[model samples]
Target: MPRSNWVSRVVGWDRPRREQPAWLHGDRQHLLPTHSHTDRHVVSTIPAAQVTKVALKLRHLVESAVPCDLDESEITRAHSSIITPEVVQAAKEAGGSEYRACVVFCLLICKAWFRQQSVVELWDADLHRGREVACEVIAKKLIETEDDTSFLLHNILLQRYSILVDGEPTYPANAIERAVDLHAVDVITSSGYQKCVDHLWRGWLVQDEDNPTTFVDYANRDKISFFTHLDPDRIRVPRYQNATQLLVTIAFLVLFTVAVNTPNPSGRLDVAEVLLYLFTLGFICNEVTKVYKAGYRILGFWNAVNGVLYTLITASFVLRMVGLGQPLDHGHEDPAHHREFYRTLSYNFLAFSAPLFWCRLLLYLDTFRFFGAMLVVLKVMMKESLIFFALLAVVIVGFLQAFIGLDIVDDMAVDEYGVIIKAMANAVMQSPEFDTFGRFSPPFGTLLYYFFTFIVMVILLNVLIALYNSAYEDIYQNADAEFLALFAHKTLQFVRAPDENVYIPPFNLVEIVLIALFGWWMPAGRFEQLNDAVMSCCYAPVMVAAAAYESNVARAIHRNRARGGSGDDYDDVVDHEWERVACAPETQVDFEAEGWDKVCEAAKSDIEVEPAVQEVRQLRAEVEELKRMLAEISRAVGAAAAGEESK
Candidate 1:
């Protein structure tokens, strides 16, 4: 069999094969491996109780080794080459649990190799070298496959080039092709294929600069390594994250509320000053951490909103501190009154930050997706409506000038601003006193007012409504992509977790010094120790309580989902066929009748064209009659010639 045919069969590409020219066969010949890969990595001898866990670990190792840019077809071919009869037999002997199947699948992927000639034409020699090293280890049986847990730590040969992945089978069919096949944007990711969607979820791990498993060899051997979360030492559990976020939010609300309520609140006071300063410090540190992780990518819409809020809060804190520093009996105007003015300015700054802070909540609630999308749609509509309002303003100005010129109203009742306002009101048919336009000279002012009102109220209002409707439809059409982008943004936040030494909010001031000045020189071990020592003593109890609160909330959500509650079904905001179906319900469409109606319309069109076709046929018949007359004339001439020949 030809090499291309062999590769096609291995990957199960069902498209019709084209014959390769003799010259192309030289390029194809080297893709075939010279020897079979017989060293199957199996944990059959391991205890059955620990089998699932070990298999899962092995699967993780295999997937983690896969390079980010590896093609689906290439991986498929490699995996297929490793699935020999011996490997299948060994997999069967080891109880075929889902985890075991996943491990066996990944083991095959690891054992899979390409001929050096296969990828020689490509520029990325490093990717091919990694695969070749993996294949060599499998061929040599250098990896310890006997013990379950021990092998994970001991396998040096496998450690260097091991493929890490989400433990699922990623097939070539899962990819959707446009200009190129995009595997990540699959609408419905089957459990098996979910691991392959790098752009959506898995890809972020490799791209994460903070990931401890940056060294492939270290990750393969490190039992505590995780693809999605931070390293074990720096890991912040999801519940802990929830706790921290809740604490910060509550602190912000409490400090701002008290400060706003204080009598002559904008005046300098020492109340909650320490707490307010601490919160501001934490906010700045967190923003810096995000910037470090994402670099130039930190400039998104939500980030900008948070940046403005941070600026306001910081300004308030600084202003309050300056006010406190000023003496009560300064040489200027009344010192106490000057202090009050400065304090008031500080309070104003704090107060203004509140709405922007609340707006940041939209970033978290984006998982619901539709609400976020609706907010975007509404923003677009408002922008379009501005133009309509501008045109309306032009008309209002014209009417205002006319009303003033005609001297149609009492000056006490209406000034220029009042005239414009009342005209606008009249335009929308909201003012009953628009009858006052009648006070103008006979036919002109009344006609003008009525005509202006009809155009502004009826025509322009409808046009604005139509514009909004179109915008809504346009947004709804691409809501899935919009929501995915939102989700990706959220994913990146966790991908760049804050330093382990940063103090938790309510007392995060220490972090400003630790992170801002000394962060680069601080060892990871020392930082973690410092953070653990401080947190365990100062705020451990509060964090524990917060974690417990988070746990209870989670349990409540699960219970609600179990009971089929209305809002509980949105566990994961994934794109699915059911969501599409639910959004657009079947309306009992008469497809059969509709199809017949289409056929009838087609027949009517054919009938309309039939008269011209019939006229052409009649012309062809007349031509045939002329041809018959010519033939008869030729036969008479032949008879006359016969008579001449007889003479």
Candidate 2:
């Protein structure tokens, strides 16, 4: 195809582009390859020749539907003396629609070629080259002009260029200014195409694809080699990524029993027992931290239950053998209580982790909301992430207050306070508040738990959703309406809620002063009127004021009205009025309201018209009989002609 005749979807036209000439597409011609492209630019000595050719062709295309006389025989013959199958084949790979919707197809190919600085640098090179070929092949079938829409041009180019997008899938950032420069402002993008582009890009890799077998099938192919042919490398996954495959290979180690009758050490501790204790300690800590981070992501009831149950069973054995590896097992008598406490701790920790994991998943889906929610809650709570000591403190105070009274800490006896730590242990599980004093008495500590949960879930959640909604509302309103709508909306809000100025409750100090000043002490309406009078008096003297404005407007409108008239009723009024003004030399009073009075006299006459075109007033009158009859006669004639033509 001749490049001159092709219409670019990117550089859209100013008029309706005509179709390609019939002769150009009578047969198909293979596109001349890059070897045929000249290394040098076109004719440097007379660049004017190429420019003039372009200018004239464009002018002719805009003005007329017919093809221009200018013709290049070599290009024309090359386009015509070819087979059709190659053309159809090229069109198919571009997409089946490209064959029929050639205007858009040409755009894709042309843009691809031009945008490419190197082989495929422009991002649309493959398609652009194809369009150039099509243009040459169908030179005779080209349209002269087309009205281009800027939005359409940008959307078309974005669609043709890539199949994937992240964030907003908008036209490339500079599209607006580029379009204004080219002046292609009328093209409309077809619908539903944007979603396909989004799917191709901004998609996540699935777990199955991360597996070893899927990896080798997609990533390792014996057929592809660098020297043999070029391939699209940016989209490929690397070999090291397969390390993610190891998540599936886990096996849990169970508790091992030691051999009986083994009494062979300095104090009697076995090496296996020491190693076993160390491993167990490390595992418990690791589990705690991991659960804290990934609680919600593990979605199973039994998994949660298992953590607590296992912690209880393991803690029993751990406390029973507390000093087994070392040489001290004297006063530590309650392994069972320790087991139960650890179990409760594990269950609570799991509960905390579950929420954290859910929050993480939400953040992954919506970064803005997740982060905003996090900031609000943290801003409210002041810290993030679990700290062991703080959690221990909360648990101690909380259960103590629940069972023992909160004030009991204040009234500890000398013996009871002697072992401060042991005293805490007394109500640590069974505090005094846990036992009913009477019908139902409770300490402040019990209320704290309910309040904490309420603050986290309800209050903090609402704050986050509120901020997000505010941001979203702003964006949504901006997208739907222009400045005028915003102005109207704000004006309506202002009118509807005059109190929205904010009813600041009167400060007692300010209220005293205001009451003294406004308690029927001053006339506010009179004060405002006096203020306006003083402001206007600073301008012209009253006589000149009325004269300056009224005299000028009166003369001007009369003059303007005179100009509109064919003959002289207004001209007479203008002369009569001007003479009266000139006749007043000293007093400078407008004389002879005579002309105006006479004009009003003819108010009933058809010649007189309202100075202001109040359309509503005009529409209020019934249609004149003559005008009504004329319209009816016209419609009758039109109907009769249609009936005659049909017969």
Candidate 3:
């Protein structure tokens, strides 16, 4: 059957039904080339000469390819027949700037002009072999330009059309093949792919040398952090590594607790007091750096929590220092009581601050991505369940109001706070007041109690559970991306590391204050500054070198393969780092090093039969359609089963 007939059959089934064809929806109407120019009349009177001028200007703009200018919709209107195949063909043959401009224009028509709808629709609708012509022009222009436009074109086609230029399943578009190409375009070229990876890695590594004004612009730091994995060894301050800082901070917190709890003989300044001052100074400095780098608004929920914790810890330390050795005589009956009051205040502050210190563990979420993903899932669940919680709150409040109006809240010994709390407890039959519901006049209280209990405990709670489960499932589906994004953000926090000497365990406190007051002026010459910037980062240079080495090797391999030399010819020049990274127990294996072997394996795995799996799937689909047609014809012709006559 023809493609149109299949669409017609599918269209017939699109009557307010579940799982209807996507074209039935307005959002997907662009997938069909039969688009109604609703606003055509407004532009119809515009002269073709004027339209052509606009089209040529747009072509120049596309060729120049300014990122900000790409979003402008002015050029989209000039995508009429004025910029036809002949124009694109002539532009291609001319082979100057016109070649690249024409390619981008065609891509704009295929992707951006139609709001990124299906490009194959052009061929499906028999729009003058648009798909075939576009592919040829694109390929020719790609050879001529050899620019990043090829990346964009390849991404659009592979992502939107499932059409790989050099690979199998080459294009002559199919509806089923189009449905499955949903993943983002992260890789482009087979050769020098390692260079792409290295570029991405280096770009992600937020540097101290980066200009604060242009950092965001140069780095594209605003993108979702989920794609790049952070390396702690490569991205850390001079003295304090990520794990070391975490451990030392934990030790300081512990010492602070010990100092508070232990009795101080003769009331002398102890280890705890010194530790307190150092921790306070370091915490304040660290937080200030974070705010300066990213601004406070970009800080996460946990960052805010950490801020509160730091404040409490600082206040408690300040209070301890202030109260120490001071005679409590001003308007105080008992000095002991006054001393006890400040002690209690400081203790309370430290106690509240202690639990929040554990939030620092969230920084290492990249190491344990599963737990990070769970936290994300919980966050999503909480966000989704808020409305449900509010609805439940309203119902519970209504029940409480009814109880108070009847003056029965007092009978249950439930106060204002207890009304909300104890009512919920009673709903679950967990409160003593649950048994006294029948004591009300007539059956009003009993009816209300059961109704509230059923609605709140059974119905609403179940609804919340369902909502949470749905959210968790959604998060789980995209857990990898979510977790990676978290890791990426966490890595950014480490980018702007302190230049001060590494704070040694107990001595770091005194050193912190010294560094604050004097470290800036204590700097050496240009060599020292360069050393601090480049060599101070322990693993960063090594990582970059490894990537560079791999990229070179990849280029060499590609060069050899291109010249018809065996890939084995270049295998003798072994990369130790590549081997280490590949063989490591925990590290992700890079497919680039393996090159064509990985690609061949992937291609083999994609095969369902020894021949083309796509062809097999397509044939199977057609056979099923034929079977369905035969059955329908038999039913319509009122034919008896041949098996019955044989029997």
Candidate 4:
């Protein structure tokens, strides 16, 4: 059936209401175009073959036959050329279907415009606004279609494109990068385009039920709140999930403390030690599952921290086990000493990991506004510090080589490299050890040390400070948007690993065992039922709270609607006030009597007075015109009187 006909049929009331359409329910397999085995993971709804065909058709429509290049001025020409009516028509013809073609064409044009804005200076406000309007229209149409737009938008947001390496047409890596490159974060995150972001969020959250994989939307929610309403069945809400994780983390930390503090001198595992081991194993499994699901993407700073903590705990466990396995002294030199040594080593490793586990609390705490904002700043500053570290490495290497070269006698006094490193580190900390370098090579070594101090302390340290400040200012200046982006990113992390059933930490160990035992032979539906039952049982308390909250919210929504108030009225009002103060004035506005005070106040402000100023200038011009007319009439009268006298 044709796509349009299918849409029409789906909309009609005559059609029997059975299960919702696959597209509507978030199953996109039938909607997405087929791809070759090699390109199976590509999220694009348009076929690869169709992409090439459309590219050819678009190339023919351009006046200049030169190949399109985003880096050069050709991007503007390509954008203009593709949006032309003739080219759009040709693209539609080549697409084998009008609706699909138009959507794909719009995406291609948007991609071009995004690229053009990045490379070219957008001094032309009209041109820029026109392109922006085009993008807005494209986004609007996608939302209206509501069939395959989610998949298409996801393609633009998540997929990377490479022409030379992949033998495909050139395109931006992803919409996010393109927006960032053009310094248009606000445009993408603006309320007018929030539906687009939501669509992208939904796409990221898609979980296939038939063939359940680890990659499932873990943090899917209609609203984000600790006490927000949600369907009873919806246990994967962000706040609830975070709450569960936070509880588990706290439990794990408490267990670790108890286990570490209790004496285990008899080489036997205590209750706390046994429970800690199980929790550690669960956490290890969780990290492994995430790494397997997300691959290299999971190897971030926090994950690295997790890796270190796990390694320490695992080593500690192994050492304890080894010590337990060792035979008694049996008249040997000192069996007690050997066993004590191993025990001490194991405890030391576990004790050292305490700080790391505490720091891990930040991971779950980031859902809060204060922590989320701080995390973003810290993340940015950490990225900035890489440059500082890279330069510092070079300086250290040069200085190390110099100091080593100076130690010609094979000193045999103090560890030469250690002393030099210690001195340099001290200098970086603003406490240079000038006297330490004197023994190496007299005045030359001392002078070199002084120079090193100046370069690192004065230059490199200051540069690092500036980078940190810039990063802090950039994030704080647009704090809300940055936090939203962070929240979205956090939400994405939970869902990136598509687990049909969420098993928080130690619980996941049970899931693994259950899956191993029955998942292979059981029917998918039965397996899902089993998982759902397990989740409900485990998360019964939270689910009950969620159901109660949802019922209340539903009642509130109905009440508001009955009172002739929209559920979103408050949000709309807030958005309107924010836009009035921060955004450019709209061409058309509806003024209400109740809002007259606000309008008057706004008119007095610099941002909202543009229209009023223009009106005032027009009135002044009218007054000048009347004055000129009166003077002309007076001169004419004088001339007529002179003519009469002469006659």
Evaluated with TM-score, which candidate comes out highest?
4
lDDT of candidate 3 at residue 533, scale 0 to 100: 48
As for lDDT, the candidate ahead, 3 or 4, is: 4
Off by over 4 Å in 1: 1-243, 264-266, 288-297, 325-337, 367-485, 496-509, 515-524, 535-647
Error of 2 at 416 (Å): 7.8
Clashes of 2: 43
Of 3 and 4, the candidate ranking higher by TM-score:
4
Clashes of each: 13, 43, 3, 7
> Model 1, 1-647: lDDT tens per residue?
12223333222232222222122121111111111111112112323334334334433443345454454444333333332334434433433443342233233333232323235546665555444343333322212232342222212111212222244212111011100111122221222122112222322112222322121212221122222122332223332443456556766767767766664543445466556666767777666643543344335555667789889888887777788776555466775546666687888898788787666655545556776687667657877888788987887778767766665444433434565456558667645355666655546567777877787878888888898998889878877755554444344343222233325543455544444454445665665566566565655655455444434444544555454553212233233566546545574456577797677667774443346777898899999999999999999999999999999
Alpha carbon lDDT of each predicted model: 0.46, 0.30, 0.44, 0.58
Which window of 10 residues has the lowest lDDT sum in candidate 3?
26-35
Which ten contiguous residues of candidate 1 have the minimum total lDDT?
Answer: 172-181
Per-residue accuracy of model 3 over 389-496 as CA lDDT, tens digit each: 799778877876776655553454333555445756666553435555555443776787878887877788788889898988887876775665544334323332
Q: What is the lDDT of residue 607 in candidate 4?
A: 42
Pairing residues by index, what is the TM-score of model 2? 0.20
- Give the candidate order by descending TM-score: 4, 3, 1, 2
Q: Which stretches in model 4 have alpha-carbon errors above 4 Å?
A: 1-184, 192-233, 328-337, 566-620, 623-647
Candidates ranked, most accurate by lDDT first: 4, 1, 3, 2
**lDDT by residue for model 4 (1-647), tens:** 11223223122222222221221111111111111121234333444445555544443443232223322232223234334444444434544553243333434444454335534654543444444444433333333433553444444343433222146433223333333333344434544234444433423234344322212333333243444433323555555676678888998999999978976877678898888889989988777754443345336788788899999999999988888876655466876556666777889999999999899989888867889889889889999999999999999889878888877554633465678788889998999999887877677788889889999999999999999999999999978777766665555444333334678888887777766666656776787778778887877777777656545544554555665555432232223555545444653344575687687877774543356687898899999998899999999999999999999
